[model samples]
Target: MVADEKKIFGHPRGLPWLFFIEMWERLAFYTMLNVLLLYAKDFERGGLALPSGQANEIYGFYLAFVYFTPFVGGILADRMLGYRRSVLIGGLVMAGGLIAMSVPGTTFFYSGLVLLVLGNGLFKPNISVMVGNLYAAGDPKRDSGFNIFYMGINIGAFLASFLSSGIRNTYGWLMVFRVAGFGLILGVIILLLGWKVLAHADRQPEKDPNDAGFGAVAGKILMPALVVGVITYVIANKFIPDFAVTPATMGFIIGMIPVIIYFIRLPRTVSDKERPGMFALLPIYVAGGTFFMVLHLNGSAMTQWAADDTARDIAAPAAFQQDALPTYYKNAGEDVPRPAEANLVVVEDPAVVRMFGQKRMDEQTLAQITARYPELELRDFDPKAQATDFSGEEAALFQFATAIYADGKVEVVEEKDAHGVPSYSAKIPEREPALRRVAFMRKTPGGEVFPTYLVTQDSFDEIYSGYEARFGHPPEQLEPGKWLPVINPELFQSLNALFVVAFTPLIVLLFGWISARKNVTTAQKVFYGLCLTTVSLLLMALAGLASDGGAMRVSGWWLVGFYAIITAGELLISPMGLSLVTKLAPKRLVGLAMGGWFLATAFGNKFSGFFGGIQHMMSPVAFFLVLAGLAAAVAVFIRLLLPKLDAAIEGLS
Candidate 1:
């Protein structure tokens, strides 16, 4: 009976274990992500207090860097680390990064973020490779296997916000981050525990004893990269802090010149037999890169939209609130205001600066100022504390009176109501004056000191000018308390995953049933994926237009529909690409090829950021439509290349 139970599934019983591991790992990752956008946003809820445009910029760069690093991780695994060792190293590193984030300081926060980038680079692609390895070359269940794995990812993704939001709301953002880190470590240990069941998946390629180690080859790559990265980092920091991001990304893209040249030249130097497979993988890499650049916007551009533009409801239900103060505040609070004409800028002109300040405030510094605000729950502090000097990080610690504050008395607004609980709406009022000092650099006798300017957002027109060109509106201050009693904005993000988790199994089964009689080629799925992605963007554009170009906040339904449709595209292309890489890669280069695919994704993810950063430079509608057009072009290109792409897969056979 035990043997039959184990043998019940056609594939190895181990598939489910791997699926769960990935799902939880993704759950932790996405949970952190839900907070990431808000973290970048400068609100009372522990945000960095940057303009949405600027925050999105930073978010984009971080994501790009995060996805990009895996190329190195993949190479290290293939040559030196091996799948098991690489996965272990990456997972532990990622876990460490997540753990560090719990500390709640920039030093720790930035370091933790870096660790996440490195850890994800290590853990992400390697496991997918192992999944494909679980099946023999001609296994018919390969597609379904990936579908199951994708389901695992969406499940975790679906739940990440809940886990993150719950911990963050109950404790602080730090707790949620640490939770994600814990999740990564748990995933690694799970893989280790299941090692015996999954041993066949880790088989090494048949190769000469003299094959170069992945680490050694990467050292050849990273050594030069390290030198270049350090030199560029120094130069950029010294010479051009403002331009550092663009330059670094451009440099990373360009720094690959040596690596790209080496890879391109290596195929020529290698034996004729190795040539076809290597070249075939190149186009796949290109496709992977383009797809991700657009797809990964979920973390950056899309998140920005959800945070700043999309309308969300207070997670708590109306029936429960059943009171005026709560309902009135909900309608008039920040993030979502009641007066459409006032809340929505009926622009006299395109470039008017109503809510003018777009500058980002230092996290620790801003936290200090707000600490001086009158306690919403009725507590008092010295007015003198306002002038007290704080070394940024040191200042953030002063918020607790531990003496008067209740343990979790302040309810944090969420994007969704969890565990059937109605989401609440609370506006923790800030230190009322709304006046803050701004420091500027000045040439001093010794070296240089900074000067101060008190630029206040006193009116709608003043705040409006501060907004990035795209949004064409004033800052919240200009429309102060406009978002008071606000509905939970971040919740819309969860709606995307909810749809995915709810529908993925059905979609998979439906597709499987359809393919039963007539198999759907990988290329066909790719085509469908592109179509869905294109439509999703169009949906967004339509929503933007309906909002009358930021003249009003559109209904939340637009975002829901957009995500649902785009997620369908994700189901089609994302995992299929993973499965394809594993299926087509030569055994020896499997890790490396997988890494190459990740490299493409890294570039694409960065592209997502790049677009997000510059989005304010143009109208949101035009910006989205431009991408929609790009997707359509890709669809056309894929259809044209389908026969060749199909043949390549066959030739691989």
Candidate 2:
């Protein structure tokens, strides 16, 4: 009992171990997420290069299933394996999955995903239950303890982004997966170390006579659900193959109907006193799902924005610039060569050279380029000479000579003798022609002038055209003497976690100060969280508008600001939701209720993907405004239920 009664940081001795384990687990999870979208969309960099919609659909299904399996895992933990054993098994399985993901081939990729989903199901819910178990029935410290644990989750997430970026940039994408696997393995070791300390918290509750056993629950709930899901999938595929949403998402939404019914019927079987709380949970579940649908876009739509529409040239340390930047930009082929020392030596208007020298182009420049290169196509041209005789935007239509010979003068070998020697010399043009040229004065150690040319490819025209149409201008041009470091787009994904780490304490203190003045209920905090999330989306909508419907790139600060607001909302909603479930659910049904919470989360995550998949189909402003409206509506709906929810919370503490 003394060992069980041990306290650390004013909570159970096991709390820190659980916190560490969850932290590492999240590190592994988020590391994978940080690179997932990029990996799916990248083509030249040895990635799958799937369409945005397909990639988003896959992301959504994986997220949904990952959360959905916890329902079964929680039930198994409650009735069969105790919490510790379940946690151990889940950790190991998840670690293995992460490792497996590093292996090449589609089979391994899908297999690893399946394992991760299964493992998360077993691990996620039971750990939260154990945290709740650590406290006594009326312990006031429970909320704070969950908050501390939640911080650990963010710490892992925050670290994961940097780690994934560093590893992928330094080594490759495959190594990132290996690192995530190793992180999970470390977490399992820590979990094992605290095995005895965690023992008292592991419980397999005795089932009441009225309770449905595992087999009945499976047959009545899971079996029927699976059948419906399969039917929905088939129907969707046969009749609506081109539906706006993926067939998998449609199937999942349809399958959830029976499970939804089961939860709805649960309150009827409970006593009158417990019924209000159980019934109140349904609305809470809906709100939580709606919130997560918007929040989890970090991996899909938001990530796409980071990759395609955000200016990522953050002033990073020199070491990162040297070591990581090259790897991030690595493609499958050899590096394209550029002239080490070259001047524009413009024969045409100097203004054209100045416009081309810009890091990004403006609308006038783009229109000029389009008009000049009306028939521009990808073609091989001499590396030593310019592709066209003209200057400025006309030059962009052809490939420029990037290679330089030892001598500054152009040599023409007109004829060769038996020994392959030049017989005679021919007249050479005064100025070497190039297709496209950008002048840059390097700031790094070399500090040499290099003229770079755009590679001729179909994507070049497509990208430029899209940019011109969206911003009513060309991409921003670079200044000759000033250079912007190219950053790995994946790095931006870390901002959310970083914001969580930075703002958690301040938000906590703010809430605590408010609660001290007026007893802030969990429901109220959740409502506040919804409002904040709406604000975050609104900020993004404004950013979209500012970007001229995502034709131009926005500043990275927009993402930072959005994440900061939403993280504050996350702190208020996510952990509080967990705590609320523990406080309100019937004692015998805590694990199931926890599963229900995750089930809602699973749906929300799935919808997050669904929305992300459709991002390209709509203008950026429309996309963000739709999400903002949904979150705002959910907030208002929750506000209407506040009185009933407050009544349900009466006497729980």
**TM-score versus the correct structure, for each prediction:** 0.74, 0.78
Question: Model 1 reaches what TM-score against the true structure?
Answer: 0.74
Q: What is the C-alpha lDDT of each candidate?
A: 0.61, 0.72
lDDT of model 1, residue 77: 63
Off by over 4 Å in 2: 1-4, 318-456, 461-484
Q: Candidate 1, after superposition: displacement of residue 412 in Å?
A: 26
Off by over 4 Å in 1: 1-8, 51-54, 204-216, 223-245, 262-274, 314-487, 516-519
Model 2 / residue 69 / CA error / Å:
0.7
What's the count of clashing pairs in each model shown?
36, 22
Task: Write candidate 2's Cα lDDT for 1-653 as tens digits.
Answer: 12257787689988998999999999999999888877765532345445566677779888998889988888888778877898899999999998888875556777889999999999999999889988888788889889888989989998888888766645456778899999999999999998888887787655767777889889999999999999999999999976776577788999989998988898898878888888888888888898889888998888888766776556785323311111122111112211111211211332233223211223344345446544322233343332224343334322222222223232332433223332322112334342332332223246633333332233233334434554466545334322245566767677777877787778778878998899888899899999999999999988888777765567888988888899889888999899988888877788888899999999999988888878877888889999999999999999999988988887555
Candidate 1 residue lDDT tens string, 1-653: 01112422787576887887788788778878777766765333344444454555566667766766777776666665666666778778888888887764457777888888888887887888777877777777788788878878888887775676555444455677877877877888888888777665665534444444655556776567667766766677677855625556555665555555555554454456656656655656666666677767877777667655655444564211111111122112235322221232222221111111112233243344335322212123332332133433223222221111122322234322112222223222232222333322223345423221112233233334423233455324323112333344445667667777777788788887888888778867888888888999998988778766655556778888888888888778887888778766666767777777776776677678677766656577998999999888878878787777777677766
